[model samples]
Every structure is written in structure tokens, then in C-alpha cells.
Target: MNTSSKQDERIARMTFASVYPHYLAKIEKKGRTEAELHQVIEWLTGFDAPKLQQLIEDKVTFESFFREAIINKNVHLITGVICGYRVEEITNPLTQQVRYLDKLVDELAKGKKMEKILRSSL
Candidate 1:
């Protein structure tokens, strides 16, 4: 692969790795149920982490893996990054609440609204 492609891949992997734990901590601090948090952890550290790592190792562009994650119901992985949510809660709380991509999209569409909801709850 070209240099830029390799760099994008590395960035993608590093981004996920760097941000995932932060997401988890937020979820825990938010008082998400233990069962919910566990689910998020399973998805983030299990399938999501390994898949992202492999995509980087295979020299896939960040955009490619990002798109695939959405197509495959792994959009939470990306959403957590953008919304500053706990990665661990992505799969647990939000994952369960979101039953479809459209639903996730809608919630994300109301980004500021969601932020308000989260903030008010706190």
C-alpha cells in the first residue's frame, strides 16, 4: 500500500485503541448497569478491537473499516469516538437501546439534543 494508506490505517487503529477505554470509563461513571457495561466491553474489546487491528494490519484505510463498521452494525464503535461516550457502554447501554442503523442514525442526528439529555441527567 501507499504511504498515506498505511498512515490512515495506523491512525484508525491508534484512534480506536486510544479512545476505547475512555468510552468505557464514561459508561461506568454514568452508572450504566453492570450487565449493560459488560455487553459493551464484550463488543469493544472482543470483535471491534480485533477487527480494527486486523484492518490496520491489512493496510485498509480508516474510511474503509469505518464504513464497514456501520454496514455491519458496528457503528457504535465510531459513534463512541465522535460523541465522547464510554466505549464500554457503546455495546452495553446504547447498543441495546439502538435496534437498527436508522435508529442509531437518528439518535446521532440529534447530537446536540442527545448531549443535552446526557448532561441534564448528570
Candidate 2:
């Protein structure tokens, strides 16, 4: 397999619980709160606080995490480069969803307004 597929394989096996703390720290360091992070995540994946906590506690891998997700209808609006690849341009659906979350967190850390980040107006 090519490098991109290999990378996707790694990401698919990675656990959401392992990454959650890092995301929280990245945002909190930028003066954002856990609630804001959750809002962003919820907007993308439709996981509420309790369900998200359950997933983390259960140590679900990214593959399982996304498999169970209720993805937002406006996910098409989440366009941008994250981790060097354009999320919209990613051919792999799973990888695109992962990047969508990354872009949302990055936007939150960059202090984007919640309404815009959530694409509420669009």
C-alpha cells in the first residue's frame, strides 16, 4: 500500500481516548474550554457529553468512533487544510472525517466563533 493508505491504517487503529486529552490541552492552552471543545465535537459527530464520555471510557478506536457517529449534514461545509491535506480533497471518507474534527479543533484553538465553527449560519 502507499504512504497515504498506511497513514490511514494507523489513524483507524488509534483510540479516541488517547487523543482526547491532547485536543483538550491544545484548546485549553489557547484559552478555550472543554465545553467549547465538546460543542465542536458534537457539531461534527453528534455525540453528546454522556455519549462522548462513554466512548472515551470504552477506549474506542477512531474507526469505531466514526462508525458509530451521527455525522452532521453540513459536514460538506467543513473545508480546509488540516495535517497538510485538504479535508474536502481526501478520497478516504474515514480520513476526511478525522480531518474534519482536526480542522474544527484547530479553528477552536484559533479562536473562531462557535456559530461559524459549527456552521450554524450556513
Candidate 3:
């Protein structure tokens, strides 16, 4: 398989829930709370805590998870490099949405204030 196909495969197969724990661990180690992590995710994806858990329980893949999301209106403000790629510059729609969450989580872990992470009036 080629590199592009491999990237697509990984994104298509990876579950948001599968990645959730790692995100939690990274933030908690930095003294950040899980609630805060969830908050940023909710801010970006418009999923409440319960709905977020449902997605995890159902093991939704990243592509499906994002496809079904009611992305926040302020999402356009979440721009930056995540995992070495610019979220805004990502050509693929699904990839960009995934990176938006990743970037938000990265910002939360890095101690960016919630107001900035949320990018609106809480």
C-alpha cells in the first residue's frame, strides 16, 4: 500500500474512543482534569458528556464520529499545527476535523486557558 492509502486506512479504522484514553492520560499527567478534556471535546464536536460516552461505547471510527458531528460554530478559530500538520491546511475534510480535535486536546494539555480553547463565551 502507498503512504496516502495507509494514512486513509489508519484514520478510517481508528476509533475516537480508542484514542480517548490516550488523550485523557496525556492531559491528566499534566495536572489537567478529565472534565476539562471533555469540555474541549464538547466545545469542538458539540457532543455532551453522555453523548460522548455513547460514541465510545459504540466504538465509532474517527471518520464516522466526525461525519456525524455537529461541529461547533467557533471551530474555525481552532487553527494550528497538530501532529506536525496544519489543521486548516489539511486537504481532506475528515482528516481536518480529526486534527481539529487533536489540536484542541494538545492546547488543553499545554495549559491553554479554556476560554481560548473554546474560542467563544464558554
Candidate 2 TM-score, C-alpha based: 0.96
Tens-digit per-residue lDDT, 26-88, candidate 1: 555655443443334333333355565565466643344344553434433333322333333
Order of the predicted models by TM-score, top scorer first: 2, 3, 1
Output the worst ten-in-a-row residue range by lDDT, candidate 2: 1-10
After superposing candidate 1, which stretches have Cα over 4 Å from the reference? 1-14, 33-64, 67-122
Give me the overall lDDT of model 2.
0.93
Best by lDDT: 2
Give the winner by lDDT: 1 or 2.
Answer: 2
lDDT of 2 by residue, 5-108 (tens): 88999999999999999999999999999999999999899999999999999999999999999999999999988888888889888888888999999999
Tens digits of per-residue lDDT, candidate 3, 54-116, equal 999999999889888899887778787887787777777777788888898888889988888
How close is every model to the real structure, measured as TM-score? 0.30, 0.96, 0.91
Q: Rate the local accuracy (lDDT) of all candidates.
A: 0.39, 0.93, 0.85
Measured by TM-score, how close is model 3 to the native structure?
A: 0.91
Q: In candidate 1, where is summed lDDT lowest over 10 consecutive residues?
A: 93-102
Winner of 2 and 3 under lDDT? 2
Model 3, residue 11: what's the lDDT?
Answer: 88
